[model samples]
Structure formats: C-alpha cells, structure tokens
Target: MSESILSISDNSEVILHFDLKLSDGSAVDSTRVNKKPAKMVMGDGSLTKNFEDCLRGLGAGDKKTFEISANEAFGMPNPDNIYHIDRSKFAADTELSDGMIMGFSQPDGSELPGIIRAVAGQSVTVDFNHPLAGQDVIFDVEIIEVR
Candidate 1:
C-alpha cells in the first residue's frame, strides 16, 4: 500500500505551523508567536477546500509553503455587507470606537458580528465584511507531523 503524508484518509492527524500575510509582506498571523502547532484531521471543513488541496500527498516531517489569493482566502468583499444603524441602538455607555467589533442579534435569534467603521450624528456605520476581504494573502505551511 502506498502511503501519503497529508492524505485525508481516516486515522490521520496533521500538525503544522502556519503564517498568513498580505501582499505587502505584512504579517497577518503566524503560529511562531505562540510557538504552538495547529493540529487537525484530514477531510475536516475547518480549512477551505483550496487550502486542504495543497496538503494532499504529504507525509510526516514534510514542510511546504504556498500562497492563496484573496478569493481563496477571506474572499472578496460584498457591498451588501455594509449597513447603517441609528445611534440610539447603542447604549450611552457604549463607546463608538472605530475598528471595534460588536455583535447584533437578529429577529431570528442569530448573532451578526460587525465592525464599527464610522460614527456620525445619530447614525453609525457598521461593516460586517471580513477584515481581509478584497485583499490577496499568502499562506505558509510547515507540516510538522502526520499520523
């Protein structure tokens, strides 16, 4: 039987160090800061299909680096994601600081997370788009071990 390193077969565990960066070379996230490896099972939806596809055919102790565009990463931003709300919706104690994340509950009991983008008289603009939306990113992966 031929065995593969990062195959998504049953009973396989994958551990690796990952770094995410922008096209400008600015680091977005890296496992190096925490000095910890991220472990996951193959075929799990935790990672996007494009990312998982890159892990195929790798064995333990194997390391690889690849880059994915914004479409494959956080995806392109949608204009419909922007919304404006009345300032009264927020409490007086609420600090309307830009770049702050806040959660709003829908009538169906689902929660939507939005970032405070701007504040104006009696109105606040919130954006529910992903922070990295519309920007290309690079992902570096180092496969530590696979079982």
Candidate 2:
C-alpha cells in the first residue's frame, strides 16, 4: 500500500522556504538567503488569510509562486498610524534621519517599530505602518515538509 502525502491544511505545521519580492521583481526577503527555512502553523494569526489560502493543498516538495495585492499582503497603509512627536522625546545623541526605523514603547510594554518619515527641528514624523504596506508583492515558495 502507498502512503498518503500530508498536505497543508488548517492547523498543519509547515516547513518551507520562500522568497518575497516586489512587483517590479526586486527582492525583499528570502529564507534561503538567510540559510534558514521558515516553519509555521496554519491558521495561526501570523499569516494573512490570503497568504494561507495560497499555501493550502500543497504537499512536500511543492514549488509555486503567488502574487498578492497590497490589501492582501501587508495591507494598505493607514493614515492614523502616522504620528508627529516632539523632537525632545528622543535622546539628544540620537541622529534623526529620513527612513530611519526606531522602536517605540507602548503602554502595554510592547515595542512598536516606527519608520521616520520626516525630521524637522522641533517635530519628527513617524509612520507605524509596515514597511511593505501599500505595495503588491510576489512570493516564491518551496514546501519542504507538511505535518
């Protein structure tokens, strides 16, 4: 008797390698480049629903590519995530520059990463949106194991 293959489904533990790229074909991230494969559980809150949908029904050794929209990937940027803070809030020695990423503390003691959008003499504009927000992306995936 032949053994049945395990495919990705809800609650399945998956190990895979993936490369993320912008729609223009610029590389953004890659597990293969990092020399580590990514492992995750399906239906975990970590993955976007659309991204999980693309992984469904795939067995080990499956190789595929998927294109996801901005809304489906990192999501569209929310204007409310932008904040302007007084320059005095930062340490005097901290060099503020456009496109710098800084971690800010939240009331719950968690850290939120914010990107510096603008730095004025008295005010600094920070955007809390994910860096890839508002951009469509492509994902190249190789399923290594599913259990």
Candidate 3:
C-alpha cells in the first residue's frame, strides 16, 4: 500500500524541514542550521491557518515550497503601531541600538515587543510592528516522515 498523506485526524508523528525567507531573498530562519527536524500536530495552532491549509494532504518524503503574501504571512505593518517614549524610561547605562527588539509592558499588564527606531535627547522613537509585517515570505517545507 502507498503511504498516506497527513490529514487532520492523523496522529502519526511528522518531521519537517523548513526555511523562511524574505521577499528580498534574505534568510530569516531555517531548520538546516541546527540539523534537526521540526514536528507538530496537524490540527494544532502552531502553524497559521493558511500555512496549515497548504500542508493538508502532503505525504511523507514529500517536499513542497510556497510563498505567502504579507497579509497571509505576517500581516501588513501598521504605522499607528509606532510610538514615541521619553528617553528617561531607559536607564542611563542602557545602550540604544537600531533594529533592536525590546519589550515594554502596558497598563493591562501585558508585554509587547517594539523595535528601536531612533534616539534623540530625552526622546526615543520605537516601532511596535513586527519586523516582517510588511514583507512577503517564502516557506520551504520538506516532509521527512509522517506516521
């Protein structure tokens, strides 16, 4: 009998190799670096609904590559998400660097990530949008084995 592709109800384990890249052909993440496989349940929310839809019927030893737009991938970046904060909030010894991801707590006791944009006297500009928010991404997937 031929191997069956993974389905929503399949409880078999699966190992997959994946590479995430930006529209500019820059590598964001890849499983090859650590030489390890990533496994996850089919119906779990670990992967986005759209991403999971693409893998609905792939069998073991199958390799597939696909691209997802900004909206489907990481969603469009919102300009309103950017904010400016007083420089004093940062400690004097703290070093400010562009493109650094920092976490800030909100009044609701939730923490949000922001990127350091710029720094001026007594003022710090930060962007809370995700780094890949506005960019399309490509996903390379290889299904090693599916139980």
Candidate 4:
C-alpha cells in the first residue's frame, strides 16, 4: 500500500524553510541560510492569509518558489507610520544615527520598533514601516513536515 502525500490543511502545523528575495533577485531573508526553519500553524495569523494560501496545498518534502506582492507580504509603506521625535527626549548618552532601529514605548504601553530615518539638530525622524514594505518578493519554501 502507498502512503498519502500528506498535504497541508487548515488544521496542520507546518515546519519549513523559507527564502525571501526581491524582484531584482537580491535575497532579503532566508531560513535555510540562517539554519532556522520555522513552524507555522494555519489560521494563527503568523503568516498572512495570502502567504498561508500559498502553503495550503503543498506536501512534505515539497519545494516551490512563488511570487508575493508587497500587499501580501510586508505591505505598502504608510507615511502616517512615520513620526518625528525631539532629540531632547532621548537620553543624553544615547547614540542616534540614521538607519538605526530602536524599540519605543507608546502611550498605550505597547512596544513598537521604529527605524531612524533622519537626525537633524533636534528632530529625529522615525519610520515604522516594515523594511521590506513596497517591494515585490519571491518566496522559496521547502516543506519539511506538514502535520
């Protein structure tokens, strides 16, 4: 008797290695290279609904490459997500530089990460957009297990 293909389903938990690259073929992220295969449960909201849709029919040992639009991946950058903070509010000893990502506490006590975009004399601009925002991405996934 032959075993079933063990396809993915809404009740499944999948373990896989995923590599993400830009349209230019420049790799943005890779679990294979990092040696960190990820575990994702369907309907858990860990992966976007569209991203999960791509994994829905694959079986264990399957490897496929697919393209994900920016909206389906990290999403488009929002100008409203950017904010300017007063340099004086930061610690005197704190080092602030452009392109630096730092965690900030919101008034609601939530921890939000913002990337430094500009450092003027007193105003520091921070962007909360995901680094991959507004980019078409390639996803190469190798399914290790689907249970």
Cα lDDT, model 2, residue 111: 100
Summing lDDT over every window of 10 consecutive residues in candidate 3, give the lowest-scoring window. Answer: 3-12
* Candidate no. 3 TM-score: 0.84
Task: List all candidate RMSDs to the true structure.
Answer: 2.8, 0.9, 2.5, 1.5
lDDT of 3 by residue, 52-147 (tens): 777667777778888999999888989899888898898889898888888888999999999999888878899998888888999989888776
Which candidate number maximizes TM-score? Answer: 2
Local accuracy by lDDT, each model: 0.83, 0.95, 0.83, 0.92
> Model 1: per-residue lDDT, tens digit, 19-115?
8899888999998889998898777776777777777777666667777888888889898999999999899889998899999898999998899
Backbone clash total for model 1 is 3
The predicted structure with the larger TM-score, 1 or 2, is 2
Candidate 2 or 3, higher lDDT? 2
Residues 1-147 of candidate 4: C-alpha lDDT, one tens digit per residue: 998888988979999999989989999888888698999899998888888899999999999999999998889999999999999989999999999999999899999899999999999999999988899999999999988
Give the lowest summed-lDDT range of ten residues in model 2: 43-52
The runs of at least 3 residues in candidate 4 whose Cα sits more than 4 Å from the true structure, single-residue gaps closed, are none
Instruction: List ranges where model 2 is wrong by over 4 Å.
Output: none
Q: Per-residue lDDT for 1-147 in model 2, tens only?
A: 998999999999999999999999999999999789999999888678899999999999999999999999999999999999999999999999999998999999999999999997899999999999999999999999999
Residue 147's lDDT in candidate 4 = 85
Instruction: Give candidate 1 misplaced runs (Cα > 4 Å).
Output: 1-12, 106-111
| Residue pairs in clash, model 4 | none
TM-score of each: 0.83, 0.96, 0.84, 0.92
* lDDT for residue 23 in candidate 2, whole number 0-100: 100
